[model samples]
Target chain A: SQTIHQWPATLVQPVGSPLSLECTVEGTSNPNLYWYRQAAGRGLQLLFYSVGIGQISSEVPQNLSASRPQDRQFILSSKKLLLSDSGFYLCAWSEASAVYEQYFGPGTRLTVT
Target chain B: AQSVSQHNHHVILSEAASLELGCNYSYGGTVNLFWYVQYPGQHLQLLLKYFSGDPLVKGIKGFEAEFIKSKFSFNLRKPSVQWSDTAEYFCALSTLVNFNKFYFGSGTKLNVKP
Candidate 1:
Protein backbone atom coordinates (compact mmCIF):
# COMPACT_ATOMS: atom_id res chain seq x y z
CA SER A 1 0.00 0.00 0.00
CA GLN A 2 1.23 3.48 -0.91
CA THR A 3 0.62 6.50 1.32
CA ILE A 4 1.30 10.19 0.72
CA HIS A 5 1.77 12.71 3.53
CA GLN A 6 1.75 16.49 3.46
CA TRP A 7 2.13 19.23 6.08
CA PRO A 8 1.37 21.65 7.58
CA ALA A 9 -2.30 20.84 6.98
CA THR A 10 -3.18 24.52 7.27
CA LEU A 11 -1.28 27.76 7.35
CA VAL A 12 -1.96 31.45 7.88
CA GLN A 13 0.69 33.92 6.78
CA PRO A 14 0.95 37.66 6.43
CA VAL A 15 1.85 39.20 3.09
CA GLY A 16 5.56 38.93 2.17
CA SER A 17 5.97 35.90 4.44
CA PRO A 18 7.89 32.91 3.22
CA LEU A 19 6.03 29.64 2.56
CA SER A 20 7.24 26.05 2.65
CA LEU A 21 5.05 22.98 2.23
CA GLU A 22 6.37 19.43 2.33
CA CYS A 23 5.16 16.20 0.79
CA THR A 24 6.51 12.66 1.18
CA VAL A 25 5.43 9.36 -0.21
CA GLU A 26 6.11 6.04 1.50
CA GLY A 27 6.15 2.60 -0.12
CA THR A 28 7.03 3.82 -3.58
CA SER A 29 10.31 4.60 -5.28
CA ASN A 30 11.18 6.55 -8.41
CA PRO A 31 7.76 8.11 -8.59
CA ASN A 32 6.83 11.30 -10.41
CA LEU A 33 5.82 14.21 -8.21
CA TYR A 34 3.43 17.04 -8.92
CA TRP A 35 2.15 20.20 -7.26
CA TYR A 36 -1.32 21.54 -7.90
CA ARG A 37 -3.30 24.48 -6.54
CA GLN A 38 -7.04 24.87 -6.33
CA ALA A 39 -8.33 28.39 -6.06
CA ALA A 40 -11.73 29.46 -4.84
CA GLY A 41 -14.46 28.51 -7.33
CA ARG A 42 -11.81 27.26 -9.78
CA GLY A 43 -10.47 23.90 -10.80
CA LEU A 44 -7.10 22.56 -9.85
CA GLN A 45 -4.09 24.10 -11.62
CA LEU A 46 -0.84 22.30 -12.24
CA LEU A 47 1.91 24.42 -10.77
CA PHE A 48 4.94 22.17 -11.13
CA TYR A 49 5.96 18.57 -11.73
CA SER A 50 9.18 16.67 -11.26
CA VAL A 51 10.29 13.53 -13.08
CA GLY A 52 13.31 12.99 -10.87
CA ILE A 53 15.63 14.65 -8.44
CA GLY A 54 16.65 18.14 -9.60
CA GLN A 55 14.28 17.99 -12.54
CA ILE A 56 11.28 20.29 -12.27
CA SER A 57 8.86 21.55 -14.91
CA SER A 58 6.76 24.64 -14.41
CA GLU A 59 3.37 24.62 -16.04
CA VAL A 60 2.17 27.99 -14.79
CA PRO A 61 5.00 30.22 -13.72
CA GLN A 62 4.23 32.34 -10.69
CA ASN A 63 5.51 33.16 -7.22
CA LEU A 64 5.88 29.51 -6.19
CA SER A 65 8.48 26.88 -7.03
CA ALA A 66 8.85 23.15 -6.39
CA SER A 67 11.84 20.99 -5.54
CA ARG A 68 12.41 17.26 -5.54
CA PRO A 69 15.35 16.96 -3.21
CA GLN A 70 14.89 13.21 -2.68
CA ASP A 71 13.18 10.44 -4.61
CA ARG A 72 10.20 10.37 -2.24
CA GLN A 73 10.30 13.91 -0.92
CA PHE A 74 8.95 17.03 -2.64
CA ILE A 75 8.82 20.55 -1.34
CA LEU A 76 6.92 23.67 -2.46
CA SER A 77 8.48 26.96 -1.52
CA SER A 78 7.86 30.65 -1.98
CA LYS A 79 10.28 33.44 -1.08
CA LYS A 80 7.45 35.87 -0.46
CA LEU A 81 3.84 34.92 -0.45
CA LEU A 82 1.28 36.97 -2.34
CA LEU A 83 -2.42 37.43 -1.61
CA SER A 84 -3.16 35.50 -4.78
CA ASP A 85 -1.19 32.53 -3.44
CA SER A 86 -3.94 31.64 -0.98
CA GLY A 87 -5.45 28.34 -2.03
CA PHE A 88 -5.39 24.57 -1.48
CA TYR A 89 -2.07 22.96 -2.36
CA LEU A 90 -2.00 19.29 -3.28
CA CYS A 91 0.90 16.89 -3.73
CA ALA A 92 0.53 13.90 -6.00
CA TRP A 93 2.69 10.92 -6.91
CA SER A 94 2.42 8.59 -9.86
CA GLU A 95 4.41 5.61 -11.02
CA ALA A 96 6.82 6.32 -13.83
CA SER A 97 5.21 3.61 -15.91
CA ALA A 98 1.83 5.32 -15.64
CA VAL A 99 1.97 9.04 -15.29
CA TYR A 100 -1.73 9.80 -15.19
CA GLU A 101 -2.54 7.23 -12.52
CA GLN A 102 -1.46 9.71 -9.89
CA TYR A 103 -2.64 9.69 -6.27
CA PHE A 104 -3.11 12.79 -4.17
CA GLY A 105 -2.24 13.66 -0.60
CA PRO A 106 -4.24 15.62 1.90
CA GLY A 107 -3.96 19.23 0.72
CA THR A 108 -2.61 22.17 2.68
CA ARG A 109 -4.96 25.12 2.97
CA LEU A 110 -2.95 28.33 2.67
CA THR A 111 -4.40 31.64 3.76
CA VAL A 112 -2.49 34.81 3.04
CA THR A 113 -3.57 37.92 4.82
CA ALA B 1 -2.84 21.61 -24.91
CA GLN B 2 -5.58 19.13 -24.13
CA SER B 3 -8.70 20.15 -22.19
CA VAL B 4 -11.50 18.39 -20.35
CA SER B 5 -15.06 19.57 -19.90
CA GLN B 6 -17.66 18.36 -17.42
CA HIS B 7 -21.24 19.17 -18.29
CA ASN B 8 -22.83 19.44 -14.84
CA HIS B 9 -21.59 22.04 -12.42
CA HIS B 10 -23.96 20.92 -9.67
CA VAL B 11 -26.50 18.15 -9.28
CA ILE B 12 -28.94 17.42 -6.45
CA LEU B 13 -30.50 13.98 -6.27
CA SER B 14 -32.24 11.76 -3.74
CA GLU B 15 -30.72 8.48 -2.62
CA ALA B 16 -31.15 5.46 -4.95
CA ALA B 17 -31.38 7.66 -8.01
CA SER B 18 -29.37 6.84 -11.09
CA LEU B 19 -26.24 8.87 -11.64
CA GLU B 20 -24.82 10.05 -14.92
CA LEU B 21 -22.25 12.83 -15.29
CA GLY B 22 -21.08 14.03 -18.67
CA CYS B 23 -17.40 14.42 -19.61
CA ASN B 24 -15.86 15.45 -22.90
CA TYR B 25 -12.30 16.08 -23.98
CA SER B 26 -10.58 17.87 -26.84
CA TYR B 27 -7.19 16.62 -27.95
CA GLY B 28 -5.44 15.68 -31.19
CA GLY B 29 -3.65 12.52 -30.11
CA THR B 30 -4.35 9.36 -28.19
CA VAL B 31 -5.31 10.16 -24.59
CA ASN B 32 -5.94 8.65 -21.20
CA LEU B 33 -9.14 9.44 -19.32
CA PHE B 34 -9.88 9.39 -15.60
CA TRP B 35 -12.62 10.14 -13.11
CA TYR B 36 -11.73 11.37 -9.66
CA VAL B 37 -13.97 12.10 -6.68
CA GLN B 38 -13.40 14.55 -3.90
CA TYR B 39 -15.43 14.54 -0.74
CA PRO B 40 -15.92 17.80 1.11
CA GLY B 41 -12.65 19.12 2.46
CA GLN B 42 -10.75 16.10 1.15
CA HIS B 43 -8.25 15.54 -1.61
CA LEU B 44 -9.07 13.98 -4.94
CA GLN B 45 -9.33 10.17 -5.20
CA LEU B 46 -9.17 8.14 -8.38
CA LEU B 47 -12.53 6.61 -9.13
CA LEU B 48 -11.56 5.04 -12.49
CA LYS B 49 -9.33 5.35 -15.55
CA TYR B 50 -9.37 4.45 -19.24
CA PHE B 51 -6.17 3.74 -21.08
CA SER B 52 -6.93 1.45 -24.00
CA GLY B 53 -9.19 -1.43 -24.88
CA ASP B 54 -12.73 -1.83 -23.59
CA PRO B 55 -14.52 1.43 -24.11
CA LEU B 56 -16.51 0.68 -20.92
CA VAL B 57 -14.34 0.84 -17.80
CA LYS B 58 -15.54 -0.07 -14.34
CA GLY B 59 -14.22 1.75 -11.33
CA ILE B 60 -14.50 1.66 -7.58
CA LYS B 61 -17.81 1.73 -5.72
CA GLY B 62 -20.01 0.56 -8.56
CA PHE B 63 -19.08 3.45 -10.79
CA GLU B 64 -18.37 3.04 -14.49
CA ALA B 65 -17.55 5.20 -17.50
CA GLU B 66 -17.74 4.67 -21.24
CA PHE B 67 -15.22 6.13 -23.61
CA ILE B 68 -16.67 7.06 -26.97
CA LYS B 69 -13.85 7.56 -29.41
CA SER B 70 -15.89 9.18 -32.14
CA LYS B 71 -17.58 11.62 -29.80
CA PHE B 72 -14.53 12.16 -27.54
CA SER B 73 -16.77 11.64 -24.56
CA PHE B 74 -16.27 9.67 -21.36
CA ASN B 75 -19.37 9.92 -19.22
CA LEU B 76 -19.48 8.41 -15.71
CA ARG B 77 -22.44 6.42 -14.48
CA LYS B 78 -23.66 4.64 -11.38
CA PRO B 79 -26.93 2.81 -11.03
CA SER B 80 -28.10 3.56 -7.47
CA VAL B 81 -26.17 6.28 -5.77
CA GLN B 82 -26.06 6.29 -2.00
CA TRP B 83 -26.02 9.30 0.27
CA SER B 84 -22.32 8.72 0.72
CA ASP B 85 -21.94 9.27 -3.00
CA THR B 86 -22.26 12.98 -2.45
CA ALA B 87 -19.01 14.37 -3.73
CA GLU B 88 -17.48 16.44 -6.49
CA TYR B 89 -16.44 14.49 -9.58
CA PHE B 90 -13.64 15.62 -11.88
CA CYS B 91 -12.83 14.42 -15.37
CA ALA B 92 -9.19 14.49 -16.43
CA LEU B 93 -7.28 14.09 -19.70
CA SER B 94 -3.70 13.00 -20.32
CA THR B 95 -2.27 12.87 -23.80
CA LEU B 96 0.84 11.06 -25.02
CA VAL B 97 2.35 14.27 -26.35
CA ASN B 98 2.42 15.70 -22.81
CA PHE B 99 2.20 12.78 -20.48
CA ASN B 100 3.33 14.76 -17.47
CA LYS B 101 0.55 17.28 -17.76
CA PHE B 102 -2.96 16.26 -16.74
CA TYR B 103 -5.85 18.52 -17.67
CA PHE B 104 -8.83 18.63 -15.31
CA GLY B 105 -12.40 19.72 -15.70
CA SER B 106 -14.02 22.34 -13.50
CA GLY B 107 -15.85 19.49 -11.68
CA THR B 108 -19.43 18.43 -11.08
CA LYS B 109 -20.76 18.64 -7.55
CA LEU B 110 -23.07 15.74 -6.69
CA ASN B 111 -25.30 16.12 -3.64
CA VAL B 112 -27.28 13.04 -2.65
CA LYS B 113 -29.97 13.58 -0.02
CA PRO B 114 -30.57 10.77 2.40
Candidate 2:
Protein backbone atom coordinates (compact mmCIF):
# COMPACT_ATOMS: atom_id res chain seq x y z
CA SER A 1 0.00 0.00 0.00
CA GLN A 2 1.09 3.54 -0.74
CA THR A 3 1.55 6.09 2.04
CA ILE A 4 2.12 9.84 2.02
CA HIS A 5 4.17 11.47 4.75
CA GLN A 6 4.39 15.17 5.58
CA TRP A 7 6.30 17.06 8.30
CA PRO A 8 6.48 18.84 10.59
CA ALA A 9 2.94 17.89 11.72
CA THR A 10 2.63 21.34 13.29
CA LEU A 11 4.71 24.46 12.74
CA VAL A 12 4.94 27.89 14.30
CA GLN A 13 6.67 30.47 12.14
CA PRO A 14 7.22 34.14 12.70
CA VAL A 15 6.12 36.58 10.04
CA GLY A 16 8.58 37.22 7.18
CA SER A 17 10.38 33.95 7.94
CA PRO A 18 11.21 31.27 5.43
CA LEU A 19 8.90 28.26 5.10
CA SER A 20 9.57 24.73 3.95
CA LEU A 21 7.14 21.84 4.11
CA GLU A 22 8.14 18.49 2.67
CA CYS A 23 6.03 15.61 1.38
CA THR A 24 7.18 12.14 0.40
CA VAL A 25 5.29 9.18 -0.95
CA GLU A 26 6.37 5.57 -0.48
CA GLY A 27 5.41 2.50 -2.49
CA THR A 28 4.59 4.49 -5.61
CA SER A 29 6.60 5.94 -8.48
CA ASN A 30 5.86 8.79 -10.85
CA PRO A 31 2.80 9.81 -8.87
CA ASN A 32 1.04 13.14 -9.19
CA LEU A 33 1.56 15.34 -6.14
CA TYR A 34 -0.50 18.32 -5.01
CA TRP A 35 -0.38 20.99 -2.31
CA TYR A 36 -3.52 22.47 -0.81
CA ARG A 37 -4.21 24.96 1.95
CA GLN A 38 -7.36 25.20 4.01
CA ALA A 39 -8.26 28.27 6.00
CA ALA A 40 -10.09 27.97 9.26
CA GLY A 41 -13.59 26.60 8.57
CA ARG A 42 -13.16 27.16 4.87
CA GLY A 43 -12.67 25.18 1.69
CA LEU A 44 -9.26 24.10 0.51
CA GLN A 45 -7.35 26.18 -2.00
CA LEU A 46 -5.06 24.45 -4.44
CA LEU A 47 -1.60 25.96 -4.34
CA PHE A 48 0.45 23.78 -6.64
CA TYR A 49 0.69 20.38 -8.35
CA SER A 50 3.52 18.45 -9.89
CA VAL A 51 3.25 15.88 -12.65
CA GLY A 52 6.88 14.80 -12.75
CA ILE A 53 10.30 15.75 -11.55
CA GLY A 54 11.05 19.45 -12.17
CA GLN A 55 7.49 20.02 -13.42
CA ILE A 56 5.23 22.11 -11.24
CA SER A 57 1.94 23.90 -11.95
CA SER A 58 0.63 26.78 -9.88
CA GLU A 59 -3.10 26.80 -9.40
CA VAL A 60 -3.24 30.09 -7.52
CA PRO A 61 -0.75 32.88 -7.33
CA GLN A 62 0.42 33.47 -3.79
CA ASN A 63 3.47 33.43 -1.54
CA LEU A 64 4.15 29.71 -1.98
CA SER A 65 5.98 27.56 -4.49
CA ALA A 66 6.39 23.84 -5.07
CA SER A 67 9.10 21.60 -6.39
CA ARG A 68 9.40 17.96 -7.30
CA PRO A 69 13.04 17.22 -6.64
CA GLN A 70 12.54 13.44 -6.97
CA ASP A 71 9.95 11.05 -8.30
CA ARG A 72 8.47 10.56 -4.82
CA GLN A 73 9.50 13.72 -3.06
CA PHE A 74 7.65 17.06 -3.26
CA ILE A 75 8.41 20.20 -1.35
CA LEU A 76 6.42 23.40 -0.71
CA SER A 77 8.52 26.40 0.06
CA SER A 78 8.39 30.15 0.49
CA LYS A 79 11.18 32.64 0.74
CA LYS A 80 9.18 34.83 3.12
CA LEU A 81 5.98 33.84 4.88
CA LEU A 82 2.98 36.12 5.42
CA LEU A 83 0.35 36.19 8.11
CA SER A 84 -2.18 35.03 5.56
CA ASP A 85 -0.10 31.88 5.11
CA SER A 86 -1.34 30.48 8.39
CA GLY A 87 -3.49 27.47 7.64
CA PHE A 88 -3.56 23.70 7.38
CA TYR A 89 -1.48 22.50 4.46
CA LEU A 90 -2.16 19.14 2.91
CA CYS A 91 -0.04 17.05 0.58
CA ALA A 92 -1.74 14.51 -1.63
CA TRP A 93 -0.60 11.91 -4.14
CA SER A 94 -2.22 9.79 -6.83
CA GLU A 95 -1.03 7.26 -9.32
CA ALA A 96 -0.32 8.59 -12.78
CA SER A 97 -2.88 6.18 -14.17
CA ALA A 98 -5.47 7.09 -11.54
CA VAL A 99 -4.93 10.72 -10.77
CA TYR A 100 -8.55 11.43 -10.11
CA GLU A 101 -8.56 9.62 -6.77
CA GLN A 102 -5.99 11.30 -4.56
CA TYR A 103 -4.58 10.11 -1.24
CA PHE A 104 -3.74 12.79 1.30
CA GLY A 105 -1.15 12.91 4.06
CA PRO A 106 -1.74 13.77 7.71
CA GLY A 107 -1.16 17.48 6.87
CA THR A 108 0.86 20.29 8.44
CA ARG A 109 -0.75 22.99 10.51
CA LEU A 110 1.21 26.24 10.23
CA THR A 111 0.63 29.11 12.58
CA VAL A 112 2.18 32.43 11.61
CA THR A 113 2.65 34.91 14.42
CA ALA B 1 -14.27 27.68 -15.77
CA GLN B 2 -15.32 24.56 -13.85
CA SER B 3 -16.88 24.83 -10.39
CA VAL B 4 -18.58 22.61 -7.83
CA SER B 5 -21.35 23.59 -5.45
CA GLN B 6 -22.43 21.90 -2.24
CA HIS B 7 -25.88 23.06 -1.15
CA ASN B 8 -25.88 22.44 2.58
CA HIS B 9 -23.32 24.26 4.65
CA HIS B 10 -24.21 22.23 7.73
CA VAL B 11 -26.65 19.53 8.70
CA ILE B 12 -27.60 17.79 11.93
CA LEU B 13 -29.23 14.37 12.03
CA SER B 14 -29.84 11.59 14.47
CA GLU B 15 -28.34 8.14 14.20
CA ALA B 16 -30.16 5.65 11.92
CA ALA B 17 -31.58 8.55 9.91
CA SER B 18 -31.16 8.76 6.18
CA LEU B 19 -28.43 11.02 4.79
CA GLU B 20 -28.56 13.12 1.65
CA LEU B 21 -26.00 15.77 0.77
CA GLY B 22 -26.55 17.75 -2.39
CA CYS B 23 -23.77 18.44 -4.90
CA ASN B 24 -23.86 20.23 -8.23
CA TYR B 25 -21.34 21.14 -10.86
CA SER B 26 -21.33 23.79 -13.60
CA TYR B 27 -19.50 22.24 -16.49
CA GLY B 28 -20.76 20.83 -19.74
CA GLY B 29 -18.14 18.31 -20.72
CA THR B 30 -16.75 14.91 -19.91
CA VAL B 31 -16.22 15.18 -16.18
CA ASN B 32 -15.64 12.89 -13.18
CA LEU B 33 -17.33 13.48 -9.84
CA PHE B 34 -16.27 12.48 -6.35
CA TRP B 35 -17.34 12.78 -2.73
CA TYR B 36 -14.73 13.08 -0.01
CA VAL B 37 -15.01 12.99 3.74
CA GLN B 38 -12.73 14.61 6.31
CA TYR B 39 -13.12 13.39 9.83
CA PRO B 40 -12.04 15.61 12.69
CA GLY B 41 -8.23 15.91 12.67
CA GLN B 42 -7.94 13.52 9.70
CA HIS B 43 -7.08 13.85 6.07
CA LEU B 44 -9.68 13.84 3.36
CA GLN B 45 -10.81 10.34 2.37
CA LEU B 46 -12.63 9.27 -0.74
CA LEU B 47 -16.22 8.48 0.07
CA LEU B 48 -17.33 7.72 -3.49
CA LYS B 49 -16.59 8.57 -7.09
CA TYR B 50 -18.34 8.51 -10.49
CA PHE B 51 -16.32 8.26 -13.67
CA SER B 52 -18.41 6.62 -16.30
CA GLY B 53 -20.68 3.62 -16.84
CA ASP B 54 -22.84 3.39 -13.71
CA PRO B 55 -24.64 6.52 -12.61
CA LEU B 56 -24.68 5.31 -9.04
CA VAL B 57 -21.47 4.60 -7.16
CA LYS B 58 -20.98 2.99 -3.76
CA GLY B 59 -18.01 3.81 -1.56
CA ILE B 60 -16.52 3.03 1.82
CA LYS B 61 -18.43 3.29 5.09
CA GLY B 62 -21.70 2.20 3.51
CA PHE B 63 -22.03 5.45 1.58
CA GLU B 64 -23.33 5.88 -1.97
CA ALA B 65 -23.97 8.65 -4.48
CA GLU B 66 -26.09 8.98 -7.58
CA PHE B 67 -25.13 11.01 -10.61
CA ILE B 68 -27.78 12.77 -12.64
CA LYS B 69 -26.41 14.12 -15.86
CA SER B 70 -29.42 16.19 -16.70
CA LYS B 71 -29.40 17.75 -13.29
CA PHE B 72 -25.63 18.00 -13.15
CA SER B 73 -25.91 16.79 -9.62
CA PHE B 74 -24.27 14.06 -7.54
CA ASN B 75 -25.99 13.58 -4.24
CA LEU B 76 -24.58 11.38 -1.50
CA ARG B 77 -26.92 9.14 0.42
CA LYS B 78 -26.70 6.76 3.34
CA PRO B 79 -29.55 4.67 4.68
CA SER B 80 -28.43 4.87 8.28
CA VAL B 81 -25.89 7.37 9.40
CA GLN B 82 -24.04 6.71 12.64
CA TRP B 83 -22.52 9.07 15.16
CA SER B 84 -19.16 8.37 13.66
CA ASP B 85 -20.45 9.79 10.38
CA THR B 86 -20.16 13.31 11.69
CA ALA B 87 -17.62 15.02 9.49
CA GLU B 88 -17.08 17.51 6.71
CA TYR B 89 -18.00 16.36 3.21
CA PHE B 90 -16.71 17.89 0.01
CA CYS B 91 -17.79 17.47 -3.60
CA ALA B 92 -15.19 17.49 -6.32
CA LEU B 93 -15.03 17.37 -10.13
CA SER B 94 -12.26 16.87 -12.61
CA THR B 95 -11.84 16.83 -16.38
CA LEU B 96 -11.24 13.51 -18.10
CA VAL B 97 -7.99 14.55 -19.71
CA ASN B 98 -6.56 16.74 -16.98
CA PHE B 99 -7.42 14.62 -14.01
CA ASN B 100 -4.79 16.29 -11.89
CA LYS B 101 -6.79 19.50 -11.80
CA PHE B 102 -9.74 19.00 -9.50
CA TYR B 103 -12.29 21.65 -8.49
CA PHE B 104 -13.71 21.24 -5.02
CA GLY B 105 -16.91 22.55 -3.50
CA SER B 106 -17.11 24.55 -0.30
CA GLY B 107 -17.99 21.38 1.62
CA THR B 108 -20.85 20.55 3.97
CA LYS B 109 -20.48 19.71 7.63
CA LEU B 110 -22.60 16.79 8.81
CA ASN B 111 -23.24 16.03 12.43
CA VAL B 112 -25.01 12.83 13.30
CA LYS B 113 -26.33 12.52 16.85
CA PRO B 114 -26.95 9.42 18.89
- The local distance difference test score of each candidate is 0.92, 0.92
Residue A58 lDDT in candidate 1: 93
lDDT of 2 by residue, A23-60 (tens): 99999889999999977556777889988999999998
lDDT of 1 by residue, A1-113 (tens): 99999999999999999999999999988999999997654678899999999999999879999899999999999999999999999999999876858899999999999
| Candidate 1 DockQ vs. native | 0.71
The weakest ten consecutive residues by lDDT in model 1 chain A span A37-46
| TM-scores of all predicted structures | 0.96, 0.97
Worst 10 residues of 1 chain B by lDDT: B1-10
Q: Output the TM-score of candidate 2.
A: 0.97
DockQ of each: 0.71, 0.68
At residue B62, candidate 1 shows an lDDT of 100
Off by over 4 Å in 2: none
